[model samples]
Target: MNILVSDFDGTLTEHDFFELVRRRWPLPPEQDPWNQYWAGEITHFEALARIFAGIRSRPGELEAMAEATGLDPNVGKAVQNLKDGGWEVVIASAGCGWYIERLLKNAGVAVKVHTNPGSIGSQGELLMTLPYKDKFFSDTTGVNKLAVVQDAMERAERVAFVGDGRPDLEPALLVPPQLRFAHGWLAQELEARGESFQPFQHWSEIAEILTRC
Candidate 1:
């Protein structure tokens, strides 16, 4: 069971899917505090709480947001290669599932997706967001991304992860040395740190590495 655990927004897709949601359901100027929040001015818990609160405040925003983001064409072929190689592929993302599902469907890849579910109310309000992400996958089944990769290693001899952002950095710290991390951010903060990562601007780099693996 060769395993590949990846992130959705920046890792697999060229766009930040969450931004699609905002575009569909434009927020009030007062609620436009996300930039300050994500820039480390506010804690993650606070940022998320405000983000959800804002979503709930605006009705029918989630569905419109989900429909706005597009998919990357290269993902389907890469996923097929992984599956053809007998690898268990999973998406470990903090983002919502609506966008991820649509993107994968467009990619024509039949694979397992692990992420938080997003629901839109009849009136177009975002009802709830589940915190399905975990810091590591060592203790559980392949639910938490790190745990999923750890679990996959039990069946496969090799494992690799691809992602971008600080959240993905958590997995980079915990994964085995044999496992590789492919960074997707154009300007990654971790690059300055001692963490080892293979920077990539596009999926072609990932395709090249997966072929070697």
Candidate 2:
């Protein structure tokens, strides 16, 4: 079966989904740890965990923020079409799976999603449970984006990788020349090195290209 791998936050969604959370769900007065984490004082995992723990302290805020962000209208239809075409769609994102899963659930799009695990404390504080410096750089915010793609490629006959941010460049490069790369960034540094990359402003363009292929 054909396989389609995509990044979750910016690529599949309209914008950076987490930023919405940060904006809508500011930490309570006691939670200065999250602010320090964002300032680069602590590892991303630590910061993210603190953020989650802080948010969980509130009731129903996380779900509300998720509903506000919604999904990429264009990609939603495209993903459904891909599934109808017998393609196994998987999301390999650097962001936390906790939020992405809810977003996908809201979008009414069902697919295999691979991402870092997030936890909530007894007090409803959000914490990132994945340890950094492990096999996948557990402490990082954008963790192992490439490694997830490589794992997908290993299991599939042919794979198409799609992503938006600079973090995704590493994983997109791993696909064989024949595979497709649906990129959201207009110009990435990888172009200077003669890498095979394709720019896509919308998933509709990707749908067109995939249909031809």
Candidate 3:
């Protein structure tokens, strides 16, 4: 069987959910952990932890806000189609598990999800945990997509990855050219690297491609 693993934030959804959270419940302007991560001064997990620490809202409120985020219109149907065709679909993301779950549930899509845990602590501080820390390769994003993809590769006859950002780059490289699907920024990265990949704008396109796999 073929396993299809995808990044949830920008690939499945119309917008980046993390960015949405930061925008809706922002930290102090002086605190710039994201820039630190971008500048290679901190790991992604450290950056996320710092950001979460600055959150004043409860988990439920954040989840509610996440539910308000939009997804690609065709994603739900495309996932169902892939499942109906006997392909296993999985969401491997660095985003919060609770947030990812809420968004998927709101969209009426059910699939296996692997992500970091996020919630509000008793002291009203934002709580986050890296469940897959032991499996981390290098960059500490908590949940490593490359590790997840590598494990999936061992079990499936074929493995395909769909993503749209920097986090997806290493995992995308692990998959063969035909099975790597890129969109948005990921496509640009692949083109710049001169790596082979299929470009897709919608999940329906991915579904169509997988049908013939």
TM-score top scorer: 3
Report the C-alpha lDDT of model 1 over 1-213, residue by residue, as the tens digit: 677787777667666655544554567755554565656576443443345444542454444455444455676777677677666677876666655776677667777777655565555444435553544322112236656666666777777777776566656655653455555542255556656666676754565577676
**Candidate 2 residue pairs in backbone clash:** 49-127, 49-128, 52-126, 53-125, 53-126, 132-138, 132-139
* TM-scores vs. true structure, each candidate: 0.73, 0.72, 0.87
- Give each model's whole-structure lDDT: 0.60, 0.65, 0.80
Residue 51's lDDT within candidate 1 is 56
- Model 3 CA deviation exceeding 4 Å by range: 25-30, 58-61, 122-125, 132-139
Sorted by TM-score (best first), the order is 3, 1, 2
lDDT for residue 50 in candidate 3, whole number 0-100: 75
- Per-residue lDDT over 1-213 for candidate 2, one digit per residue giving the tens place of the 0 to 100 score: 678777777676666656665665676645665567646687655665555655544676666665665466666687777766667787776667777887777677788776776655576555556635335453465467677677777777777878876567777777754454655562365466567766766655665566557
- Candidate 3, residue 30: Cα displacement in angstroms equals 6.0
Model 1, global lDDT: 0.60
Candidate 3 clashing pairs? none
